[model samples]
Target: MEATYCAGVLSRGKLPVSNLRKSDHGFQRLTSQRKAIASVSCHLSNGLGESSCKSHGFHGGSYHGGAVGKGKDPILQTRCSAGVSMYGESFLESHSHATEDKIGVLLLNLGGPETLHDVQPFLFNLFADPDIIRLPRLFRFLQWPLAKLISVLRAPKSKEGYAAIGGGSPLRKITDEQAHALKMALEAKNMPVNIYVGMRYWYPFTEEAVQQIKRDKITRLVVLPLYPQFSISTTGSSIRVLQNIFREDACLSRLPVAIIQSWYQREGYVRSMADLIAKELERFPKPEEVMVFFSAHGVPVSYVEDAGDPYKDQMEECIYLIMQELKARGINNDHTLAYQSRVGPVQWLKPYTDEVLVELGQRGVKSLLAVPVSFVSEHIETLEEIDIEYKELALESGIKNWGRVPALNCTSSFITDLADAVIEALPSAKAMTNSEGTSEEMDNDPLRYLVKMFFGSVLAFILLLSPKMVLAFRNHLF
Candidate 1:
């Protein structure tokens, strides 16, 4: 039933713009229902707003779906009569109240080319980002020309890649499915939400999303990047661009925005990943014998070394946590993490996925399950780079069997998890980070390292003393 609901949403991905506009009424209905339950206003990172969101309901405010709650916000306390049966009895019944505060969720991702002609320009937009190609401030002026040159040189090969993957990338389709699923999930939970998709460098770009958000008159905004693990080049670049645009406009500059930078550690996200792996493992005759290979998208090494980007660190930790979750599920298969999609003459995060595959093949690890860890939706990276190119490489490298985990696009559990993250972020969303290192404070803190080391030693000692007790210790630590 959940799969059916997800399928319904996926089908909507191809809907024309006119049809999508028609769906606004459904979102407004959701907003009106949610406004009845909660009246609390936006909670600012700097400080709480002087006037509550509830105050606008009675003030003849021009906001869409008017203020939701009058005195107090009731998130899930009141049950409405509207809910899908697939969500079970726990979902709140939908109700209506006057509201002007419409919750707008902006989904951010690196948009892909829809045709071969778009490949070069997409590549240019990607390489043009200073985050992708680091340049000293004095030399930054060269980025545009350099990006142009690289895109021209790389376009033919990239065009072939898209050609193999049905002549385009399915990223936008998958992302739209995710957006629709999230909207349903939020509405089921009795929250007013309208989801907007914003691709960084292609059609429906960030600027376009902002324009739509403004046109719709969204009262409060929640920015959720599709990247689970935060990276300076990906999430950081998107958020920074968005905040800069918001600052330029008087209305948007004053609009309250909540930011969910990353959710790599979220339990539901980990579980959804584990579930995908488990399903993939079932395809193998000997599931336990197959090795788990996590292939994350790579970034220039200098981004981490010189710019203090914590992406590499976050990727490592994310892999560890996912493995831990798999272990908890009693799947103790050997696993390896490698980076993929490297570009240019410069070194990227290593060991490269292709290199790792070659080494594994030489070592006679015959069966393998490749997981695309950095991406949540199907794109050229997964369709061409992993499934096509790497699969052929793996099979030719003497691997008897090979498989790749499907991207988690609109999976019910993952969508529910996203809805929770959005709801949690709305109340205390901070402005996007200004500097690259700002997001890495907790990761770089000396005390954090000391505590981790202390706990690591303790766990090791406990394992040596009593293997059984390690289970208890693990439970406590988690």
Candidate 2:
């Protein structure tokens, strides 16, 4: 007998119906709203839509196993064999049609000194990164140990920096808030996307977040380093660390990612900064006459000279952009850009922020507005270094008005612009599929790599030699 398949339907206390064809059958297509209905139909061979005949393993009416009603054929089987290949093709077609596109956004940041107790340790972590320290392998190890020792020794002094700023770093709290605000702002635009925050030298590190993206099955990632101004020292370091992590992790070997690198020149960012400065100037007794002082985070001059880090240059560019924005808004005023937070008696980019403040006061500039161009959020540098320390110096030097332009943390327009940047940076789905990526760059020190490789080879050679030397000694003894 020829094996046959049939579609049959049996309702409670009703006679069964079987073997219906496309021309004679009355079956409807499934609608999203009608998912509760228990029904099955088949698109069979010979280009026909057959409602009663089950060409695949599907039968109408409740689809439960065993008999239907008073069971003539106790085992109701549907003979729907639409070949495995065809089914797969159809599944792929449907899946491709159903899938929605998404953009992945990675938020790059400097990990902060967490807790009152963690301040010194956090600074040690920051100073230890090779990108920040630029020491040789042996010297790097020596430097780290010395840095640790120095950190312990200097803890009291650094604590003074923290103590003046309220005894702890507010960076973590502010960054967390910024992340949430950015997320909400993006979602409001109906451009729902994932926003990940990765810090350079702390928890939720770049490596950890990269692993998380792997776990989350995120195929496309766009890195947005939080620094408004791009510096080889700040944004470059973070990007380099991320690149290194990607190179080492096998799971991330094939993932697709892109980098925004910098948005310092973006109009929205410049305008937002300009607006902050303008608002601060409004508090002054004279807005246009007020001296505007812009201070950015300072890096060692050696790093700038050797690596040609564009930190100072980019900061100048950012300041110029903001000033231009201010000028366009009809608020032209004399402004100064100075570097802040130089440690360890080294020559940093000068004239220094503190010195400038004192000079402005001494020159008899009555009102001053200090703008922290480098920081997007209020942290130790802005809160403690400038707000407290420099403000006091200015006040003592006889400047009656001294106030700071607040860091752009969770401001509506600033957050919206950030969200816009994320949207702009998202890779096309096709591009995401073809690209292989991450952010860690190789160490610029060739000697470090050579030493590591040499030591590893030497250790292996010694291990191999040990067993043979022991065997030779044993044979001689025998």
Runs of candidate 1 with Cα error greater than 4 angstroms are: 1-100, 430-478
Highest TM-score scorer: 1
In angstroms, give how far residue 186 of model 2 lies from its true place: 1.9
lDDT of 1 at 287: 98
Model 2 scores worst on lDDT over the 10 consecutive residues at 1-10
Model 2, range 1-478, lDDT digits (tens) per residue?
A: 0000011111111122222212211212111122221211111110000011111111111001110011111111111111001122233343333235444567777756555576666656565545555554334334455446545755666677777667777765676677677777867766555566666555545555555566566666667788765555466666555544554466664565656656665557877888888888888777888878777777767655655554555555556566656776798788776767765444466667777777777888888888877778887778777888888998988899877899998888899888766654442212222132212244569888688767756664474368765464344212
Tell me the lDDT of model 1 at 322: 69
lDDT comparing candidate 2 with the true structure: 0.56
Q: Which ten residues in a row have the lowest lDDT in candidate 1?
A: 1-10
Per-model lDDT: 0.63, 0.56
Model 2 CA lDDT for position 401: 80
Query: Please, what is the TM-score per model?
Result: 0.71, 0.68
lDDT of 1 by residue, 139-211 (tens): 4435666668667877877888889989888887777778778888987877767678777666556665676
Model 2 spans > 4 angstroms off = 1-99, 136-138, 428-478
